[model samples]
Structures are given as C-alpha cells and as structure tokens.
Target: MASSMLKSAGEIQNLIFSQNQKLTHLARCGRIDEAVKLFESMPARNAVSWNCMISGLAKNGRVADARHLFDRMASKNLISWNTMIAGYSHNNRVLEASQLFDEMPKRDSYSWTLMISCYSRNGELERARWLFDSMPGVKTPVCYNAMIAGYAKNGMFQDAIVLLTEMPVSARNMVSWNSVLAGYTQNQEMVQGLKFFGEMQEKDVVSWNLMVEGFLQVGDLESAWSFFRATPCPNVASWVTMLNGFSKSGNIDEARRLFDEMPERNLVAWNAMISGYVQFLQIEEAYRLFGEMSERNSVTWTTMINGYIRIGKLEKARELLDSMPFKNVVAQTAMLTGYVQCMRMEEAVELFEKISTKDDFCWNAMISGYAHCGRMDKAVELYKRMPTKSLFSLNTIIAGHAQQGEMHKALEVFKQMRERNTVTWNSIISGLTQNGFYCDSIKHFVLLRNEGRKPDPCTYACGLAACAYLAALQVGKQLHLLLVKSGHVNDLFAGNALINMYARCGRISSAKQAFDEMASVDLISWNTLITGYALNGFGRETISLFKEMEVNGFRPDDITFVGVLSACSHAGLIDEGLKYFDSMSRDHSVERVAEHYACVVDLLGRAGRLEEAYKLVTEMPIKVNAGVWGALLGACRMHGNPDIAKFAAEKLFVIEPQKTSNYVLLSNVHADARRWEDVDRVRSLLKEIGIQKQPGCSWIDIKKKVCSFVSDDPMQPGATEVGFVLEMLCAHIRNTEIMPWSSLLDCG
Candidate 1:
C-alpha cells in the first residue's frame, strides 16, 4: 500500500511541474486571457505559476489584475515580491512600487533596482538617485547602470560621467560607456559625443549607429554619410539611417541606391524606405515597394494607407484600410484625419464610430474636425461624451468658438476650464481682438499677467492691436516696455504691431521711429509706415517713403498702392494718383480691386474734378463695391454736386440699402445744394427702410482705463463731469479772439 501511494505522488508531482512550465510560456507569449484560464484551472499551483501570471498581466498593461493576483498569493517568496515590484515598475506606478518596497519584510538588490528604475523612467531622477545611494549593500552592475541611464536620459551628462568614473570595474561595461555617449549625441552635442566615442577602446555597432543618427538629426548629411562609410561593419540599422537621412533631405535617388546596395534588409529597413517616399509625396514608389515586400507588419499596412491619404487618394486609402488583416486604432485615426483634411466630416464621423477602442488622440481629432468645419454643436456634443478631457481638447473647443465669432460660447468654455496654459489665454485674447472687442481683449491680457502666466509674443501682439483701435497710447507704451523686457522686441510680428499702434494713435513720427529701430523689416513694415503717413495727411512724406521702399528691393503689394494712392487723394494730387493707378496693372502687375478705384475717385472728387471721377467709376474694370460708391457720395457732399450725389446714392441703395451713412451723406448733399424736395425724399426713404442709424461712438483712455462715449447717450459713468468739461471748452473757444490770415502773416 505504501509503494502504491508513493507511485501516485510521483505522477502528481510531474503533472504540476509540466503545468507550471506551460503556464509560464503562455504568459510570456502575451496570451493573457488563455494564460488566465489555464492558471485558474490548474489542479495545483506553485509560486512560479503565480509569479508568471502577475508578470504577464503587468507586461500586457493589466497592472490592476496583476496586483489582485499578487494580494491573493498563498505563500510569497523573495522572487514573488521582486516580480510584483517589477510589475509596478514596468507599468510606471512609481508610488505603488515605492509603497510596496517599504512594506517588504526583506529587500534584495532587484527590489531596490526596480524601484530606482521606476523613478528614473518617470523623470523623478532625484528619487532615483536617493534610492540608489540608500541601497543596503554593494550595488550590482544592473543597479549602477540604471542610475547612470537615468542621469543620461534627463540630460545630466556631468552626473552620468561622474557616476561612470566611480563605478566598480565589474560594473563599468559597454552599457555604461554607451549611456554617456548617447547623452551627448541625443542632446545635439555631437562634438562632445565624437570626442567621447574616440576615447572608448571598445566600440560596438550601437555606438557607430549613435554617431550616424546624431549627424542625421542635425541635418549634417555629408558628415553622417562620412561616419557611416567609416563604420567597419555597418548593420542594417546603419544603412537604414543613411537611407532615411538622404530621403528626408529630398535626395531620394541616393536613398534608393543605398537601399539597393544594402547586403541584408529587415522589415524596419523596408518600412523606413517606404515612409521616406511617402514623406516626399512620391506615393507611386511607396506603393511599388509595398507590393514587392514579401513580409509586412501592421506598420507596413498603416504606412501605405497614410501614403494614399497624403496624395488625396482617399478611396485607395480606404481600400487598403479595409484590406488590413488587423486594424488598429492608429490606422483608423490616420484615415479619419485624412477625411477631416478634405472636410468630409460625414465620412470621418462614420469611421470614427467604427473604431472599437478610442484613445485621446482619436477623440481630439474628431472634435477638431467638427470645430474646423464650423460645426461646434457637434463638437461640443462629442466633447461632452469624451471619457477624459485633455487640455488640448479644451483649447481646441475654445479656439473653434472664438474663430466662428461665438464670443459668449468661447468665454463660457474658457470660464469652465479648471486649468489653462499660455495657449488657452492666447486663444481668448486673440479671439476677442479679432471679433472687435478690443477693450475686453486688453482686459484679458491684463488678467493673464495678474494670473502669473507669462505672455508669449502673440499675446503681446494682440494687446498692442487693441490699444491701436482704441488709440490708447499710454497702454500701448506700457505693453511695449513689457515686450522689450520680455526680450521679444526684435520679433517681427510684435514690432509690426507696435508700428501699427503708434500710427493709428496719430503719432506718425513715433511709428517711423519704431520702424527705423526694427532689426529686420518685411514688406508689411514698409506698407504700415507708408499707410500711416497717408492717413495722417503727410502726402509728400508718403510718396518719398514709397520710392525708398522700392529702392530697398521690396516689391510693392496691393496694400502698398492703397497707401500711395490715398496719400495722393488726401494731398489733392489728382494726376499723380491717376498715374499710380494706371501703373498698378502695367508696372507692378497688381490687379486693381475696388479699393484702388475708390482711392482714385476720392482723389478726383477732392480736387473738384467730379466729372472725371464719375467717368472713372463707370469705366473701372472690376465691379464697383459699396466703398467705391461711398467715396463718390462723400465727394459730392463736399462740392455740393447734387446730380452725381443722386447717382451714387441710387447705386448705394442697391448694394447696401441699409447703410445709414450712405443715406445720411446723400441727404447732406441735397441740403447743401438747397434741394429741400430731394433731401426730404432721401430722408423719407431712410425712414421707410427702417434702418436705425448706429450711434457714433468714440473711446478715450483716462488713467489707463478705456472709457467709451456714444453720441447723445448720457448713461455712461462720469457723464455729468464730461458734459461740464465739454461746455467749458466750447465757451472758452467762443470767447477767444479770432485773427485774420493776413494779420497772422504780418505777425509771422
């Protein structure tokens, strides 16, 4: 009976050992569900089986499941504790790993190293170093290597080198040497990297690959190729690096030559070559290579699909997507982005719904597509449905509403956001400025500073623009000082904005000063100052500046001509204005739009050549717009030409029937000519149209605050004080002496 019982026990022991081995293999292969089933059904379990399951679950991104299995282990050993710590480390749960490390009854080198590595990977290098120093016994090479890698990864080259020098001889291996070398190369310090590479007595293919990659990254292709050729035995990775370098630099022919000459090609090399072609819009070559490949992974299929999408062959892209053996979220997202680029939102939506698992990127892409197409309602609906809201998504939504002129919606979204970055603040400030809420834009800019968010160049530019519209010179100067302090005074965008602000505030000289001080100037700079001179009635200076602008080799755009012709109009230089207008098409090749034509009409009208101006209006090549007719009517009102005024008004009525100024100008023209019946008719038509005239409004900055006043509206703050000041000024002007021009000339 004893012998029979011993025989059955031996069989049972063999069965358990075989089952443990099978479970370990299955877990390592990433068949987590099958491994779980097998684990649960095991007739008897051991430590190896349990540890294998935990490791497998963690490696497959099921950390919670691994922890649950860990807590239920019947008898835990050193290896079991180490494996659980490794699981937390691998999954980036540093806090959990550290907590578990502290709870360990007995710790080993592996446990300490795992905790250190977890901190290093998550950018908590200080904690990593602390754990490394506090390790109980003599450190192993693996532990030393982990600490050195953490230093190298975070750009602490000095610390990594010092640690390498202090490492014991047994621990000072190729990995340690390579870690320091990679630090220099990855940070673009190739000179130091090359110096270090030469110092090493032993170099591997990885070391050579780092040098080649470093050169390629900095756009030094010639140097990269030189290093590549000097490599004693270049691996597939070496050849692939050269291929990618040449292809990215628009030298595809060389890449192909190198590719064909490669002794052995891996799947990575093939994918790299294919991606290079796609990047340069050489889709046909990419497709040909895709066909020639005998082996392909998911990357290969996705690359081809993206290639078709890049060339706008969406149908082909979809065909490949459907043909993919296994569709991942990345491939599907690429197709969705393609549809969004083409504004095919419906197709994008359909594919978006088909994605079985949606990531943050997938959600943002769909929301961006809807927002870009001005479908905010749909975007918001999807945003509400998003499982996790990221900062980028919130910024996208805010920017979308602001772009579509939905300020209230944008502000509502902005206020609802619990956290914001510089981009978030910039979006709202820029939106408010663009939508003509200048005061509010500046107010937000101030609030941004008070909140301790340093404004970028764009924010400063937006603030300057608001000051320009409000003619708030004091506030503009303050922003300029702040911009200079921020070290962005030489920024092209900010400099141009400063010029515009000074110009609009009737400070033409200050505008010129800002322009002259700029380190560099583009066409917009020249145009801005020229327009400033014209708007301020400095006609001679405007003409001189235009000639100087051309002499500086800056080609004049249509906007330049607007400033030039407007200068001539304001200065009553009719002939010069006509000459410039004619030269627009002949000399400059600039097509004359309605604004140009309007300038010419104003030129003639101001010079009392109404007949000539009227003829030009009838004969201009481009169709006349409201601006052109408005210019004619204003001129008629100045010269009391009722007939031309009537003609201009009739056209204005058809083009902009509800414009209050057009009606007002026509009525003024009739009244100036003592044509009461005509005036009455125009006024009657204005009343019939039921177009309430927009009240004339103006703004002035008082003690750094922008105050607005509407004509004949008395509800503004400090209205009584303002009225008192205005009455006193008018009375003083009436009581002052008036001198004749002849007397003034005698006095001069």
Candidate 2:
C-alpha cells in the first residue's frame, strides 16, 4: 500500500513537501514562507516539526513567530525549549531567553545547559554560573562541561577549576578534563595541564591533541613536535597544531609545506593556515589564503580583518569591515583594534559607542588602546565607566599609569584591585622600583609576603634591580633566601639581578655564585654577568664571558657591546675593543649608535691615542655631546696636551656655554700652559656674566635614609670629623715633605 501511494506522483510530492527534511531544505535555501507553509500542513508535529519551524523563524529573525510557535506547542520538550531559547539568545534576545526559562513548566539538564551557554556566549559568566548552580535534577557531564568550558573560555581558570571540583565523580569525564587542560594550556600553564592528563586513566586522542596544543600555544614548538612523534595515532588536529606553531614562530615555509601535505583540510585547518600568515605579519599571504577559501565564515573574516589591523593597514581593515555580508562582535573588534592601533582613538571611541552590547573584551580593547596611545586619563575614565571590569582592563590601565611615570595612580589602582593577581603586584612594584622609590618597593615586597602572596620571576627581577640601585645588600640577601625557599633561584632574571646586586655591594664572590647557579642564560644575563666582572676589575672573566656569549649563539646587542667595550677600555684592551666595534655592523648587524661610538672614543682615549681619538670624534656619525668632548679633554689633560685639551674644552663650551664645568676645564687647560693671563681673563668674564660655579655633590643612602655631601660643605652632620681629618692629613703631609708628582702636567 505504501509503494502504491509512492507510485502516485502527486501524493508522493505532497508527502515529500510535508517531511521535516524538505522544510529544513526549503529554509536553508532561503524559502522561509514555503517552509512555514509546509510546517503548517503537518498533522502530527514532532520535535523535528517544531525545530524546523523554529529554525526557519529564527533564520529570518521572525522573533514573534518563533515565540508564538514555542508557546503554543502543547507537546514541547527540552529540545523545543532549548532551540527557542538558543535562537533567542543568539539573536541578542537575552531577556526573552530568561523569561522563557522562568516560565517553562518542565526544565531538563539540556534546558539549564543551554541557558548557561547563552550567558557564557554573551560574556555574562556570572549569570551563566548562576543559571548553572540553580539547575535542578541530577546534572549530566554536558552541563558540567558547558559551565566549566565557559569559565575557561573567559580566562577565569581558577574559577573553572573550582567548578570542576564541584562536579560529581560520575560527571568527571574526559570532556571536563579537556576544558580545564585547554584553558591552562592557553594560559601558559602546560605542566599543570599535563599532570591532569597523566591522572586521566582513559587517555584518548582528544586528551593527547589538547596536550600537544597546549605545548604549541606557549611557543614550546620543540616539545610539541616531540609529543606528535610519540603519539600512537596523530589526527589532522595535531598536524594543524605543528603548522600554527611553526608559522607563529616565523617559519612560514614550514607551515605552508605541512599545510599542502595535509591529507584533508577542514575549515579549522584552513583557518589555521590563514591565521599563521597573520601571525607572521604576512598580510598578503593571508589575503591570498582568504581569497582561496571557497566558503568563508565569521572566523575567516575576523582573521583577515585582524591581520590588516596588525600591519597598520587601517584602510584595508575598514574596507573588509564594510564589505562583510554580516558583522559580529569579533569583526567589529578587529575594526576597533585597527583604529586603536593606528592611534585613531576618536574612531575607536565612536565605534565603541556604536556597539550596543559591549562585552568585557570590547571595554578592554578601548581602554588598552587609549593607554597605548598615551591617553591615560581617557583610558581610566573608560575603565571606570565599564559596568563590568576584568583583570585585563585593570592591568592595562595600571600599566598606562606606570608607563607615564604616574606611580601614585598605579599604586592606588593596585590597592583598590578587588582580586589582586601576581601581575597586579608586579606592576605596582615595578612602577615604584623604576621611579627611584626603592624603599617603597621593598616595603611592598614584604607586605606581599605577609599577605601570603607568592612573588613570581618578574617581581623578583624588579625587586633585585631595586636592591642593586639602592645597594640594599641585606634586602637582596633576604630575597635570595626567598628565591631558594621558593625554588626560583634557577630563574634567569632573578639570578641576573642577584649577580648585579652582589657586584654593586662589593660581594663579588656572591655574585659569581649566583651566576654559576643559573641554568639558562640570555644576552641580558650575559651582559649583567660581564658588567659585574668588568666593574670589579675581573677583566679576564668579563672578556671570557663576552666570548662565551658568541659561542652560545647569543648575538650581542648594543648593551652587550657597550658592557664588553667598557671592560676592554678599563682593562686596556683598546685594540681588541676597537676590532669588536668595527665588526659590530659587519658581523652582528648592530648599528653603530651613539653609545657604541662613545665607547670607542673612551677606548682610544684610555689608550693615549689622543690625536686618533679626536679625529674619530670628528668623524662620528652623530654630533659629539659635552660628555664625549669632556672625556676627550680630560684625557688630553692627563697627556699634558693643552692645545688639544683647550680645543676640546672650547667645543664642550659651545655645546653648553652656561655650564661652569666648560669654563673650568678651559681655564685649567690655560693654567696648565702657564697662561695665567688667560685664566684671569676667563675668571673675569665668568664674574661679569654672573655665571656661578655649581658645587659638586654626592649622596649616600644609609639605613633607608638619604644624606648628601658637597665639596667643602660646612653644614653637614659629619663636618666636624671631616674638618679634623683634612687638617691632620695636611699636617702629616707637610711634616713628611710630600711633593706633587705633576703627573697631570699643568704645562705642556
């Protein structure tokens, strides 16, 4: 009988039109009215019947029609409500989703999970958690996974962990594990995530894929490659992970080769390739890949737009934004970032205002953009006006104040942070440390310790730097103990800072110990170690380390070069240092900046090649400053060459004529030549011009207190002792008939 009915072509056509698949096809092909007509003719509607109709209405944004169908369904089940709720939520109808949730007669796990997902998708994690907690009935792993993934996606990893702990043992499935592991991996906590994987007895491909991805995300490409080789059955995901890692790390050819060799390419695989191009700043390649995408999604558009923004191609970003067939928050965000990055703050602000529903990220982008553009006050204002704030928003604002030298504002923000993280404390400490407020930094380090907040490497580095600046040996020693206790002595930054502090405080042995303890070192690490050795006259070690840096594949930068050159200058390795300076541009690709030139001049001057050094100074690429000329003049004084000394002093005077040092240097050069009339004439000119010689002063920081000393100062606290020492020294010298050596000849 069924075959006979199918043989009737008209009846078969009618039955086909009534099928759910037929209606869905009609809607998918944009025949909404036909879909609705077909849905209306269904005599016995099932979940599919309602889903088809609801999807059609949702597709066309016919909210009232969807809601009408939802409420009128006498046999509506969990899928029906979930579909309607998700449709409403996705269409930016959160209030309707909420009301439907409130009015539903029966709520299942799917119902609660869907609502929570809606909140999470909209950046309302708090509401998502609220809905998650209020869910009735025994929860499924899907419900737990959805909420946990939401937290993880939102960068609330600690909260995600907390939620994971609350799930029943039965619900602690592989899906739940993947969420937290992926979150940790994204946050650069690979070790913690790997531990979770090890504890999972049922190790599946998903777990392995996530583990590999975690390594890849944090720039540990070598480790990820090792894992990929060890995997029993690697999927396309693993391949894509390697491709992304290589491309992001600046291996585009490798990424392209892997991409071409892929067995199959899904949308994700394609996006990875496009995104790789973006990461390498190869915008043209990204566009080429984008153009090759026969079909495109929001992710593809967003990636292309973001690439344009990153490369300072704002017009391209806007054109892409304008050409989009549909626009989402991600696309808008890319456009906003383009404007922000280009310092088009007004454009960013205008776009931000146009976003009717701003999320935490939207606010973060604007505030961070303002901060980056030096509009700190505007950043703070926008940050304050955000209805909801995240750690990112706060951090960006704090960094702005810190960078602008507004330490007080940074401190205030740190104090007011409701949930202070390691970065928050580090920022405030760094600000105080950088602004010559070492005492305050130390005080906060102690306060942070008392508050049970463990310091990270950055905190230790900043603290050690502060200690070096203040010569706080005791404080640095305590920090060293903390480093040992915390098992962070192997950290390169802390180790480097320790070497600096010990060297500055005259504990060269301790500095060497710290250097020896370092397990890994970079150029800055080598620079610090060498600078310490050089300043303490351990010239052999300094030169040895400079050689070691080259052998270790650490190409020296200007700072490293300067440190090595200074050591050479001090140790009389003038010829070797000059060779290094000459080789900087040819061998290391380092441009000969002013500091490098100054170091060369010092090296030559120290070697008593006064004429050659003076010629080098004249031919320098940059204008010679007073310091460089002053150094040359001082060297000439030692060599008893008053003619060159006078010429250098005059050059210095022309640079800053009002500086009394120039007058003093020139007059002394004349006095050295027995030109007393010239000295008298210079003195009279200074008196006539009302140019007073500023007193030379120095200060010592004692017990967290500052005490200043001036040359021949009469009002110092130690004046009595200083006066007595001078008289006794003079009397002893006269009694012994000491005579001047005239090494610094007054006449040439």
lDDT of each: 0.87, 0.79
Off by over 4 Å in 2: 1-172, 176-199, 214-223, 230-236, 248-251, 309-314, 328-370, 373-391, 412-419, 477-521, 640-748
Q: What TM-score does prediction 1 earn? A: 0.65
**Candidate 1 lDDT (Cα, whole model)?**
0.87
What is the C-alpha lDDT profile of model 2 across 206-314, one tens digit per residue? Answer: 7777877888766577888788778777788888887887887789899899899888888888999999988889999889989888877778889999998888888
Give per-residue lDDT, candidate 2, residue 707.
Answer: 79
Which tens-of-lDDT digit does each residue in 279-375 have in candidate 1? Answer: 9889999999999999877678889999999999999999999997656667888999999989998899999999865766788899999999999
On the 0 to 100 scale, the lDDT of residue 561 in model 2 is 78
Cα distance off (Å), candidate 2, residue 345: 5.2
Candidate with top TM-score is 2
Return the number of clashes found in candidate 1. 0
